[model samples]
Target: MGIWLGALRRPLLRALPTALGVVLLNFALLQLVPGDAVDALVAEAGSATAETTALLRERYGLDQSSWHQLGDYLQHLLHLSLGYSPRYDMPVLDLLLARLPNTLLLMGAALVISLTLGVALGTVMATWARRWPDRLLSSLAFLMYSTPGFWVGLMAIVLFAVQLGWLPSGGDGTVGAELHGWERFTDTLRHAVLPACTLASFFVAVYARLTRAAILEVQTQDYVRTARAKGLHPVRVRLRHILRNALLPVTTVAGTHLGGLLGGAAVTETVFSWSGIGRLTLEAVQAREYRVLLGVLLLSSLLVIVANVLIDLLHARLDPRIRAT
Candidate 1:
């Protein structure tokens, strides 16, 4: 327990500065863009008088200098406020909270599917080593890794939703159905299938290749040789010795991939029209809703930081050497 806590402490300490840096960087980058929320609004409205434009800018604090705006933003952040979204006409934090769960659900489902399938396929590849199964699975993993996720999603929708009529093509659930209890859960799951699979595909390939490599490397270790010499069952040796240690690298890769997964989720959500943070992020970007965009980026940075910290603790638990150090 103390080891786990100690493992967590370092990452938690670094998180604040990391998050602040991300906020500052994103704010600066957004400032480089040509227009503010007002510009987008004005364009959408066809035209606005100079006075109306100025008033809108003042209303949203867009009239201020970049440094001044950033200072005010940091002040609001300190107060746990995410400012307002002119596009959504709501507090940025509130708007994010509403969509956060859908993104989380999509990410969580993708993670589980990727890890489960990747590890299994990797194990098979490792077991077969140089045979047909290993070659076939390796080729498949490479194909998945190279293919674009959005293209995969489009094909999935066309095949499953259009051709076979198996699942809904878009959105997070069936609209106006007033689904309840298990029905609601199942409907949401059905809608999630394509997006989750699309998101998982690339990661599954990555983990599979990584796991196969790690297992092959571990199989050559002295400990593994000794275990085999003891005449243990092949399955026990494979699982308890080979696969367990092989998973350390897999866990590290998974932790680092969270950010990538979030980025991929943005594309996946846009492709499927899923009402998640990713979709909201696209809308915010299109509308030049800097406040909402910044909020999303900040939240994403914190989530990745938190996930990496937890992964560190898990790594410690998995490897006694880490705890001892």
Candidate 2:
């Protein structure tokens, strides 16, 4: 318990400054862009009088200097307020909270699929080593790793949704359906299938290759040789000795990949029209909603920080050497 708490404390300490830096960087970078939300609104409305444009800019604080805006934004952060989203005409916090679950769901599903399948495929590749099975699986992993995720999503929609009618093409769930309980669950899962698989494809390839290399490397260790010499069952030795240690690298890689998963979700959500933070982020970007964008960036940075902290704890738990250190 003490060890875990110590591990947790360290990351928590670092997260504050890291999150602040992210906010400042995102804010500064957005300021560099030529337009603001008012510009987008004016374009959408097709025209606005000079007075009307000035009033609109004043209304959203766009008329303020960048430094002034930054000070105000930081003030809002201190108050736990994400400020307003002119794009959605709501509080940025509210907008994000509403969409966060869908994004988390998509991310969770993709992570599970990728880790499970990647680890299994990698184990198979490692077990087969120089044989045809290893060669075949390695080729597949490379193909998947190289293929773009959006293209995979499009192909999936074409085959499964459009042509075969096996799944819905887009959106998080059925529109206007009065689904309840198990029925609703199944419907949601069905809708998720394509997007989840599409998102997981590249990651699955990555983890599979990683796990294969880790396992192969571990198999050559002195501990593994000793386990074999002790005449333990082949399966037991492989599982208990080789695979367990092999997972350390995989776990570390997975932790680092969580942030990438969120980034990928933006593309995936756009592709599938999932009502997640990722899609909201795209809308925010398009509308030049810097407040909303900053909120999202801050939240994302915090999430990654928290996730890596948890990963560190898990790593220590898995490897006694880490715990000792």
Best by lDDT: 1
Off by over 4 Å in 1: none
Error of 2 at 264 (Å): 1.6
lDDT of 2 by residue, 1-325 (tens): 8989877888899988899899989988988998889899999999899999999889988899988989998899889999998878999999999999888889899999999999999999999998999999999999999999889999999999999999999998899999999999899899988999999999999999999999999999998999999999999998999999999999899989988999999999999998998888889889888888898899898888888998899889888998888
Task: Give the C-alpha miss distance for residue 297 in model 1, angstroms.
Answer: 0.7
Model 1, position 218: C-alpha lDDT score: 95
TM-score of each: 0.98, 0.97
lDDT (C-alpha) at residue 292 in model 1: 91
Total clashing pairs for each candidate: 0, 0
TM-score of 1: 0.98
Model 2 vs. true fold: TM: 0.97
lDDT of 1: 0.94
Score each candidate by Cα lDDT.
0.94, 0.91
